[model samples]
Target chain A: MRHALILLGVLMAGMGLSVEAGLLGPLGEQVGHLSATLSIFMVGALLLSLALVFAPKRQLGALFKQPRWLLTGGILGPVYVIVLTLATPLVGVGMTMVGILCGQVAASVAIDHFGWLGSEQRKVDGYRIGALAMILAALWLM
Target chain B: MLLPLIFILLLVGGAVLAAQSSINGRLGAKAGVIESSWLTFVIGAVLTFLLMFFFEPAQQATLFSVPKWQLTGALFGVVYMLAIVFAVPRVGTAAATVAVISGQLLMSLLIDHFGWLSNAVRPLDASRYIAMALLIGAIGLIYLSHQQRHRRLASQPS
Candidate 1:
């Protein structure tokens, strides 16, 4: 039951992203793409900052004590945004998203297989391959 | 040549994105979900600010000049970051990532079909329905695999 809820939560997040893309398209048209991307993070960060103000103080310290390497995760957002900005016009959105989806699934399987970044080791067994095959077929159809 | 390289870079970026989920999820487990999401947004804001300052060419309209409703769309990004941060620690990286991806694909098709949020209406076709079904199947398979793997691990000696 608990797992189902979190899956729903994240799934909704993904759904929200599609809406975001729809909205951002026009915004990007008005402002330059980079500026538009910057606005998203800026606005989001501003909101989170306000939320953090009321958050439990203890977690605030926990945030600072983290290992240096973990901080790199945050950088990926900018990298994704910048790359998409560059790729979208050139390759177009469909191909770009397909590439991203393919990369995500491939890397996810690899990460689980190697137990990288504290994720548990789960080899790319038959079940995982089946799942991957479905995902690829779905992408191809798209 | 440049096109393939850009495409490959996107692929690598996607892979790194999966890794980011695991890493940030672990961070969220240690810290707080809000904290984890906040940290990334802060980093993202600062980095993009600099990038925009340098590279973004001038446009006729600025963010403030845009309709207020458009700005609200950025808030959805926060929702996404928060959800991933909350989910990864609970579901593990691969499961959460796939779940999120399925949701994205599912919604993208819906939005395309309905023309929601001002996007063009692309009516749902046979291919879109098939894609949605496959996505659902894929999500179920990944969830089952994750549960079985964890059950097996739990049964084994530490």
Candidate 2:
């Protein structure tokens, strides 16, 4: 039951990204503004901060102390959101996503194989490489 | 016209960055999802603000003018962050992502084909369908490979 909830949460999150990608990508174009994306991030940040402050006391500092890891992850948020917003207007959301997915799949292979940045190192084999090739071909055809 | 394309590329680049960050978030989130998410947004906000400052000052506005409809993205972001954190522990990232991509493609088709929102383009034709099919196939292939890897791991003796 707990596991199912977690899976549901993850699916919801992925769906959220997809929806945002579709909506914000076009929204940026419609409003002639990219700042809204930033604003949204700020709002989300504010909301999260407030939640943390009001929650029961915990050793949050331990996580913050790992600046290398936190910073590395912290920086990607805006970059991904901004780039996604930029891509939507140019190539259309679908094509832009196609390109992003291709990059993501390729990177996933490397990330899993190398276990770079403290990830669990998984073996990379022919199937993985073939899958990457297939994605690239699909993107090209699309 | 080109401006929109430029923005779209920026968003895609942001997605790559977010993916990498997500790994970090997983490692760091012992503190709390809210904490991790907050820190990430703070860093991202600063970086984006600086980027906006240099490249396109004209587009940057001193006062934020919130559009009636633009707030929808914020709502979506909230749902997205919560969903991501929730999904990771359950179905594993690959399967969760498959669901995401599929959902996005379907929603995107509707948005594009019907022009549900004002100013969205309506592209309903053979080309669009072909593109959608290729994308779906690609997503399926990726999922299949991931499942294969999982099965192999399960079969292997530790």
Candidate 3:
């Protein structure tokens, strides 16, 4: 039950991030180019640094040591944003958002159940599977 | 512009990232979620800068021209990263994602429908509400089933 709550929280956070990104997309478009996007990331890094300075030393060190994982995650961040930015220009916000939602729900199910890419293996059951199907269908219809 | 196509692609990209984040969360949880999140942001920022330097040198100078409003997005990002770390431990990835999405959709509706951002007001119509409802429903179904499976597994334990 606790785990389920955690998963829900992650999903909500992810969703919030997407909406925020969408809001920023217009600004990004106005600014134009990768540099503009990168600047936002730089600010994010700066904020993270500030956070680290206030945190315990041991915690900070532990965070720094996971470089490889961080790198992997880091790569995804830009790629995801760049792709999203490109897509927004190609399609309207509504349709683009729908597509992303569909893809997320589908991929999340697989990641959650099978423990893909070193994730903790959680059981895939009927309801979750059905939900994925429904989301996909919703995306298609939208 | 091509609004529909962009929307579709954004949705797909968003989904991929969502899955990736879930995996990342689980992997990073063992190491400490905050620490992992911080590292991911640092690495992601560095990589983004490198990509910009190589591919979009022409726009580098414009970096300083960034508007103050955009910084709001960065602030939101910080809140998001922290929320992901904190929520993952209590709710699990799927549920956490749902909660975030629910928050976003509600917020987005307000922003778009009310023209809260000073942009053109895109009224919240029935279809948009319907879409949000379906998405929420889908999330609920998945979380409920996940809990059931977990319970069953606990009962069968070694």
Q: Clashes in each model (backbone N, CA, C under 3 Å)?
A: 0, 26, 50
Model 2's CAPRI class is: acceptable
Highest-TM-score candidate: 1
Model 3, C-alpha of A128: deviation from truth (Å): 1.5
The better-scoring model by TM-score among 1 and 3 is 1
Error of 3 at A127 (Å): 2.1
Over 4 Å off in model 2, which ranges? A1-11, A22-34, A54-59, A81-97, A124-142, B1-15, B18-22, B52-56, B59-64, B86-99, B119-157
Per-model TM-score, in order, reads 0.95, 0.70, 0.79
Count clashing pairs, candidate 1: 0
Q: Second chain only: TM-score per model? A: 0.93, 0.63, 0.72
Q: For candidate 1, lDDT tens digit of each residue in A25-95?
A: 78998988777888888898889999999876647788789988887777998898877888988999888
DockQ of 2: 0.40
Q: What digit string (tens of lDDT, one per residue) describes model 3 on residues A1-142?
A: 5655565555556556655565576666665656556666778788877877786753655544654544376677787777766775566566666676666655665666676756566666777666666555544444
For all candidates in order, state the fraction of native interface contacts they contain. Answer: 0.80, 0.41, 0.59
lDDT of 1 by residue, B45-74 (tens): 889899889988899999889888887777
The C-alpha local distance difference test score for the whole of candidate 2 amounts to: 0.57
